[model samples]
Target: MVAGGGMGPDDEGISFAHALATLKEQGSALLVVGSVPEELFAKASRTMLGDPDADPPRRRLVVTPEPNPESAVRRLRETGPLSAEYARVISRGERARSAAVADSFDEMTPRTHVVDDSIRGLGTTIADVIEEFDLFAGGLEPAEFRMAFDCLPTVLATHGREVAFRFLHVVIAQARSVSGLVHFRLPRAVDSEAVGLFEPLFDATVELQVDGDDLHQRWHFRDRDITSDWLPVGDRP
Candidate 1:
């Protein structure tokens, strides 16, 4: 899982493109959960669909509670990986109203599900979250899917920590049953005691820190070796 402290501006530089690329190449389903949907899209664009000339995944599903899909497409086109290509694609599809259509490139567009929280008579309960996953991932092979839970803190805030924990427990089970990769992001600013509850849920923990032009990342494989390295932002790995 790609967990970050998100304590400062530098913390935003954390990159999980490598992980996403690996999972996609393995043909896995992906679940990305985040408070800010745009950031999630940008991450996917940079890593999973970074190669402007490469093909899009067969089933890249993105579910969000946000309303403006067009803004998401704009974010990807302006700042995501292959920004120039995304921009060109948007230019060509200027009249398209949906992000899936506007963001489509090289003939591949991810399936996007937008759950507007502002809608009347809508429920933002934990069950609603799980239901969305089921709708997108039901019957899909775990090995063929990779999911990202961008930030659980938001869920925790909406529903009590206990409820959020139970929800994740169920989600993780489904992911493991399908052998799909599950990546989660949690802010470091959360209570240390509460954060401990997530440790056993994840196999490994990764930390990313930005120092000047260099991005430093450390991986702690529980009960295994720890690896740390630095990468220059402008230089490709």
Candidate 2:
């Protein structure tokens, strides 16, 4: 079931903060589909990770395709301070591509797990890494963990739609089992048609766009046939 919060429709629109709070409170899988700036993507990632100072303190996992380990760490640092124990990264296929990436992972606080792109093995490796994080949480509630799958388009292209779908199905199931909030990023520019194919796998889908200098986002919640108006993405409440 979808997590409930003060996200009900109002005369204006669904409050972005309220919508996000709902997802964070309960474990849910979300798909973010759009073509927007990298900075905006970072903002959405930060939102999924939630406040670092939260009472229970959320653990974060970022699955990225970035080949440069330093660059990936930098981007994550932009989200907030990195706690080696609470934050982790699954560097997909980057370890084999660069020696530097492999060595860097060994020396990072937000420990990194490097895995190859084999379609058959990728899902297992990711699930294993998440399980490691879950164990580290010491049997805390699922809401204590958050994950960001930052390379949906790359995975789709590398494994094809059918294979990618299967992989996502497994990952989403893992998320639900642990009640962890997980989100996959899909840039519509890569394959717009793929959105519909994958939307059913997620509890909700967030559509983002840019209009001149402003950025806006609309959320389509699956459990409830509710869609929020395009509201400007602003500072977190």
Candidate number of the best TM-score: 2
TM-score (all chains, Cα) for each model:
0.50, 0.81
TM-score (C-alpha) between model 2 and the true structure:
0.81
What tens-digit string does per-residue lDDT give for candidate 2 at 69-163?
55456545655546666776777665435654445555444566667777656677677766876787776585677778887888888878998
RMSD to the true structure for each prediction, in A, is 10.3, 4.4
Candidate 1 on 132-173: residue-level lDDT in tens? Answer: 444554554433333344436556676677776766776666
For model 1, the local distance difference test gives 0.40
Stretches of candidate 1 exceeding 4 Å from the true structure: 1-58, 69-109, 116-143, 189-191, 225-227, 230-237
lDDT of each: 0.40, 0.71
**TM value for model 1:** 0.50
